[model samples]
Target: MNSELKTDRVFLEIFKNRVQAIVEEMANVVLRTGFTAFVKETGDFGTYLLSPQGETFGCPLDTGYNLSLGIPAGDVISSIGQWNEGDIVICNDPYSTGGMATHLPDVYLLKPFFYEGQIIAFGLCFIHSSDVGGKVPGSVSPSSYDIYQEGLRLAPVKLYEAGVLNEAILRIFLDNCRIPDQNWGDLRALMAALNRGERRLQELVERYGISRVESGIEDVLVYAETRVRQMIEDIPDGEYEFWDYIEKGPGGYPVRLRCKMVVRGDGIFLDFKGTDPQVRASFNIPTLNKQGHYYLVPALIRYFRTLDPSIPWNSGMVRMITNDAPSGTLLNPEAPAAIGARAATFIRLMDVLTGTLSQAQENKLPAAGAGQAAIVMLAMTDPVTGGRKVGVVQPICGGSGARPMKDGIDGMDFAVGHLRNIPAETVEADMPILIERYGLLPDSAGAGTYRGGCGIDLQLKVLSPDTVLTARNMERMEFQPWGRLGGKAGAYGTAVKNLGQPSEERTGRIDELLLQPGDTVSFFSQGGGGYGSPYKRSPQAVARDVRNGLVSKDAAYEQYGVVFHESKVDLDATQKRRSAVYGSTDEQQSFHFGSAREQFESIWSDEMQLAIGAALTVYPLALRDYLKRCAMKEIDDRFHRGEQVQAIEVAEIMAAIHRTIAAL
Candidate 1:
């Protein structure tokens, strides 16, 4: 309760924006100095200022990954021994720093800003490393079952001690990584950004005075907390429950994510009690069970910003909200769990959060969109130097869900959308690869009054031998994005090997694929779900989509009942078709999850899944993944034989697996 900040309203607003501008300027410094394509070209980096206590108070508006707006910095701050005048602490271990890094590739650094022999604030910055020491070239693979296999796990330590270089630690890190020189360049870029932020912060303290600057930092937290509470109070106090998944269910469990959001007055409680157990894949999110973790409540944060439009980026926004994502779940796994592909799970968690909150608000949020992204990278050996080289081909971006009044963003989802698309020429220059096709997927979006966004279609050919193609965060292939309010479901993701060739084959999600010279491959991202009924859409709008090559005439006729004759809609025939298909439509349903998911949900009812999910958890962590797959195989056999399963019979199936497998 600083009286200076409490009374001076205009000064507080200026202080907030000034802090943001400093960080924004810090972003430019990193882009100018960063070496890797991920840093300079893709812009997979961020710079911000934190309170002395390590709460993020300022973040850039439109740079880097906005998905990490409320990222926690306190754990990294507390882990280090002490803060000196010119020391920079860095770490990438998710387990040691209380899930501050989440994955190894994302290296985070924190620097304390001091003035007059006292700590004023902290400078925080992070950049995604092209590669750290790991099994794969990119240091990311779905097959990685533990953190050790992912990359070099660094605990919080003094990367820059008293403004002097720590060559001993630097040499060890460089020796472990793939491209030592480029990685070191990126590290220097981060240090430069931190130093730039520190300079601006010193100027801020000089202009505003030490007492006022300190008061402003403390006041922003109180302001953000009060504003968030006011917004949460608007919703009626009730418990709303919703669930979603990552498609790879163990037996029937898949990686199901369930949330029970309880809104009571100004405080919101998120209980993730029914989420599926951690899997063997690199999909776990090590959140350390922190209250209102950034992973658990990203959607809610987006909602708050939408409502207020100027909410402060700090820890106080989460002060009124509490979370209970139980230990052992993917959201809060134990130590050493693989988290290379945790971004995929983080995207799905947003879906579950949006679904839960949509129940409380009437048409507040749009239906789910292509809620995933895959980073396509090509790895090869440089012929001249025989050195390892990896280049990001492109980001497989997806469309957003259709909104109530507007269509979703086509071919670029807001989730991790800040990662820019690399140019075709740049891809060619960096690696021996040829771009065959790169554009939006036609007829991929859901059919609704307001159509969902379209996904990407990228195909490339390798020009060199012994090339490895890796794509991470591939999802939504098994379970397509579901639509709400009588809207139809969107298209599912597709991956193919040698598409349209004599050796054509449909590949699902690719962990890793080695390519030969002249071999071509294709990757298609999923489109977003639509909002409202397709039949109610304007025929002209459907015709526009057809003309733009985003929708075919046949789909326009069948899905939207829009009769297009010679590229022109025949309104009379369209009206008749709509009237004829009225009775059998999805008008009565609140959510249209498409035929595939609908049938899957019908076959594996919630009762059966809950029973099976619980049964699988009883086994040891190492044994559950294997047992679940075996149990699912047995269940699949029963399905093929036309046998129906009840919840009561689940125990018998579990007992059989336990006896046959556990006994051995």
Candidate 2:
């Protein structure tokens, strides 16, 4: 290599490593001094270093999910005035923060990194605080009607001036939050962490010069962009469409999510044009640009890692893809749209994207994983102490979908991985809830030759009255995570409790369910779909899984066509059954859940939900949620008004059309 070129490459690598190490130290600084358990123990925080031009250059990989928050950080910087060196801008407004802090609980701060009287880079950090004062104690709920109901929304304001902490702003924060002491502690920790990040960054500039740091940022992004483009180039370019549904919304109607991608060479355009419009509840996505970042980054990261993990996360990875989601769709909602549970929609978006990419390049992508194992907190006030106690008693998740050559990993965290379930002992000690049961649900995994992962089962009994539970980004209650090949579908999810009688199958939202000492609640999460035909599965493997309680013997017989006799495998009978059911391996039987798919199919189609959701997006929350549930009244009221019929009527029409066509 040429001497000049070699020098530049060496300098770039050194600069990149230095900046990354600085961000790593920044997170450590926050956790060490933070007051809240969420930040100190759970480590629910992130640190990033941004370029001068409002671009995310680097971030700590281990902390936070990915670089999606980078967009919000840049937004914070640009929205604020000409920021000074010591001015630290803080905001948690989903709208004002440019979707950086997705919800209120997450506190985001942006500080300009300066060198010799000029702004060079920005240091950013965000932590999910334990409480922010809302309708619920934790400031999150699936049924939240408005952002105000969620919690305090902070605009971009300097929490610090001339390196002096702004006590007034600090006091205002502590005054509103339920846990004032912990909130103050976490705020100080965030400021301290940013200072550490800034200090380390300055040291790097001193060592390698600012010019080298700038060049390294460009080089790292260029390298990542090239690898991602090459990966996209290998696939046969064409337009592909994939659509999925969410079973648990305001009215429990399936919300249709459609994505049509046009891929030509190294470029791709993702259009959610025909997708359903926004809903009234917390499922709506708040920021357009942020939503785009959230969808593209994770998918590219997953795909690129399959090729090489050495690729740095920068704009280059997502440079090849463009998003075209309209303002009113579920993916991009208007103002006042409740977005606390939007992560659930993102999970389906990732799944739909993966499914689409798989069709284009089968070998490049992994099968669908447990979509989103979201954390649902049930918090209440202690009657005696008058203090708040929160418990993440059940963080529900499904099994990962089966892979090409291997079974899916059980209880996987697909979108973000930093979420760790709080220990039962910690909850009992800190709160009044009793964790009765927390374990994997057997026979819940999708059945195939390579089985999907199994989801978790949780049972909690509330010991205090007036407890509030906020369940966000939770789905798979109706449409289960799908499988590839001939894999059987996994079990659907459920959330119920003991009401008047001991057990009654009840469904729907109970935001403020009054509970006595004996009242018990149970939540069963969904599982991932399997891959390949079950008949082709090895009899020995099935037996082992059955023995381990991962797979039941009945599931083996029903899904895999494998039978065991008195604890031992009936090899002869199993072979005979496999041959009779599956016949020659060459002839692939397309097993149809005529009843299963039809069950959801009868309610709505992708096209209908898109049309209705589009129309409903312009309306207020109550109207949108009403359209989702009591659309029958809407259909009957407007059948002849020349306006388009609702989804319920459309489903009925489609069914009638099918009957007519079948008769012909």
Candidate 3:
């Protein structure tokens, strides 16, 4: 592969930059011309340059919509069958393109680049539309159990032929979605990005020959694969295991995601053998059982880039990695399975993969960050048009986990921080809303030698009546972000209505709620986890936190072993508190999962979950939900009766399920 290219290292480096510039220009065009808040403000979209073989060769330099490197172009590119000059195809259904379009909201379009009547490359781009015709106004709802309930599903079909617009397809789409004009504006922006990529790529072909351009694409992929494999070698070769859970499954049970990572020589294998089967909820990830699907390899992507930033940012980075997630699992769900809320599961997958890497790296990695990112939206009556208007409020995310050498970032974690936030002024101007509070939550940081970043707080008051609100990806409320190496766990998140008023009520993990005029709502993000022991943290650091309003003086004395006198640390009092409070703490403790997960795991351990999942597998997918709930109810009753229920087997559980269903 190396010798066939004939392109030297020096020339390849320059060639890589030139190709990357084309993609960056494409992205810039989309940002400037987009209509929806998701594209214009949140930047929930991307552009990529793909070879005829469907490998991503060029992508944006930064991590904004960093999905360009991981998303496959082959399925979508080939789904249209044949491509002609001045032709474009589009698809929004995940099942049609084989996971190419993750969800219906993420619409994909591709334009093939032709040289002398032969295809040489392709340009692809996508936008997360605000509405795509679903049961709800925004096209996404937590209650959706099937794909049909989510939104309109577009199969691989041509939206343009011979440079002429196919108005029929466009009309069908616009008629279904609530926001037709805005969706049309975003679609035009994507077209602009694709055309720009095609033109810039043409200039590259003219500068270098066509053969060199084709060879350059293949060579760069090889280059990235080699570099990624070398980084994988840094981790000691071994089988490392890790697992985490999603808050709600098909029947609202906590679904577990387990992985066994085997690193050998220059390759890494991710074995998701113990993962739970697909449920009837929106948490399923449509991976299509593809090897090293982009959704499955984010931890590897982050780790490689963190160690060596120069690795080529393309699909080649995942060339040497392999995935073994069984079909029907949460990571590889079948068709008609709801996936509107997969973004929440996407964050969890990254956290779970990072957990496996932490074990392989000997706990050198940073502790867990807030693994959840909430997309808050509001729907109100439009004053001018007298129709329903929906707009995004904010993409609220928490802080980064504390690193071994440095403190975590505040009020924004790295998981989805690349996506921008909506400004308060923008929200107020777009809808009848008032921003009450938009800042970090105090005392939300995890305590350790290096403190984790604090969580985010957003409070808004509705000025109009009949206002409805929806918050997606709200998690870490029950299970806190875990601390590492004897550190204290981060604070949990919460949502409340009419805060500070007589009507104050806690709304934990809400799907949708109605708001009256002048009613206020507050939402929070889970704080990041810390690294190392809190007793080892410097008193000066604790005092600084108190002064900054991030950590209160009382919390400093209680959580951290720090004492203060008149806004200053008292060394003698601090020493006494350290010995009296944290002296019994186990410094060797590798993780602090807070009381929620610890207490829950005591009864519903890994063995218990595996038994339940395995027993339910034999039954049909449709009946598994009812059977699982029944089996769990028996365990629940037995455990509550102080029966120490470890003696149950799959056969016994099945028998109990039958009895429960028969009685019903």
Largest lDDT belongs to which candidate? 3
In model 2, the worst 10-residue window by lDDT is 585-594
Clashing pairs in 3: none
Clashes of each: 2, 1, 0
The TM-scores, one per candidate, come to: 0.96, 0.88, 0.97
Q: Residue 249 in model 2: shift from native, Å?
A: 2.8
Best by TM-score: 3
Q: Residue-wise lDDT of candidate 1 within 490-519, one digit each (tens)?
A: 898989989888989887778889888889
Lowest-sum lDDT 10-residue window in model 3: 61-70
lDDT ranking from best candidate downward: 3, 1, 2
Compute the lDDT of residue 269 as modeled in candidate 3. Answer: 92
lDDT of each: 0.83, 0.70, 0.84
Error of 3 at 181 (Å): 0.6
Across residues 269-315, which tens digit of lDDT does each residue of candidate 2 receive? 88777776677677777656553365444665577666777766665
| Alpha-carbon RMSD of each model | 2.0, 5.6, 1.7
